[model samples]
Target: MNRTVVRTEDLWKVYPQEPKPVEAVRGVSLEIQAGEFVAMAGPSGSGKTTVLNLLGGLTRPTRGRIWIGEDEITALSDRELARLRLESIGFVFQAFNLLPVLTALENAEFTLLLRGVPAEERHRRVRELFALIGLDGLEDRKPGKLSGGQQQRVAVARAVIGEPALVLADEPTANLDTATGAALLEVMERLNHENGVTFLFSTHDPRVMERAHRLIHLVDGSVESDVAQGVRGGVGHDR
Candidate 1:
């Protein structure tokens, strides 16, 4: 059975400065179980990215604790946190962030390479991931050659190629058209259902919230509401 993948206790993020600090996340607490798809929705500069950074181990909280399973990530060294992120978390950013020189397969293969997976296994995994994300025919295409949706598909393939327990997506559909964005989200939803991977995304789009199984709304750096799928009125389906 899948386990609870994330737990945040009174999480707080404050950007330090000479005078008053900017508080981004203020005493927020959350728990995400395996196979759950949760969305963090808020206006711009409302601590959504800060929350994502904290969850992905990219930024340590100024106060409180973040635990990925039993690991207290906020207490780890930078190197340790980096290693843990590499091994346990997959990230999808607003920008595709694919290397312009690498093909889709090569981009996906990069994640496996970082994990010390052998070339043969990496190749196998990359091909399988590409096929899973509907990027099979475009494996050899560079980011410049692929459409925005196709490139985002490659990014998703790269992010989940290793099947990490947690996937953090920050405004994943920000760059795509309506139809393409919906398709990309469907791919993510399918992945969560079929693979039991937990997804914690920071998004402000109605489309993103529409598909989420839960929406945690943030305002002024604190959680204003936590609504489950189907409990609130929305435009999308959650299964």
Candidate 2:
């Protein structure tokens, strides 16, 4: 049986604006099972990013509850939440977010270093992942030296090196060209298939929605529709 990796109930995130409060996410609720490749799609300002932030504990909801596995993250203390995020949640942003000063290898293994994993082990894991994702020879390059696709691939390596239970990616492929984006998606799909790493993405790209096994559409801060479909080539069929 597939385990429920994420669950939200009556989720709401309201920003206090001058004229009135803006509801970024209102009464949004959903469940994502482990190992599922899911995408949340909507127009700009449709609250997809807000929902991902709430699920990742980057922001507290104005109302409602969120759970990662059995723990209710909304109830966790700030410090506790930080720890949980570090250990169980991975994030990829539209901006590659790679530190310009660090080499690709250093950037990829930074999370492991934070968790105090020994140097040798961190290198071992990152090198293996880099090879798997077609990043073998670019390890010594910094973000400035790599192409957009390479930088994004390094960012992906960083996100998954620790093998987090869930990865929340917001517009991960927005900055890449069509071919580059497709390649990145393939890398993510491989991770989801081989390592059981669950991915929840907030994307506006149709290509992304097409690759996802489950797609949730949001509008005006609410879930307009949620559907399950087969991925291209049946790579992520329901299991």
Best-matching candidate per TM-score: 2
lDDT of each candidate versus the true structure: 0.85, 0.91
**Candidate 2 lDDT by residue in tens digits, 189-217:** 99998988999999989999988888888
Report model 2's TM-score to 2 decimal places: 0.95
TM-score of 1: 0.92
Best by lDDT: 2
The alpha-carbon lDDT assigned to residue 96 of candidate 1 equals: 89
Per-prediction TM-score to the true structure, in the order listed: 0.92, 0.95
- The CA lDDT at 46 in model 1 is 90
After superposition, candidate 1 runs with Cα above 4 Å error: 230-239
lDDT per residue (tens digit) for residues 11-129 in model 1: 99998877898999999987777778889899998999899999888878889999987899988999999888888899998998999999888898887888889999998888876
Which portions of model 2 miss their true places by more than 4 Å? 231-239
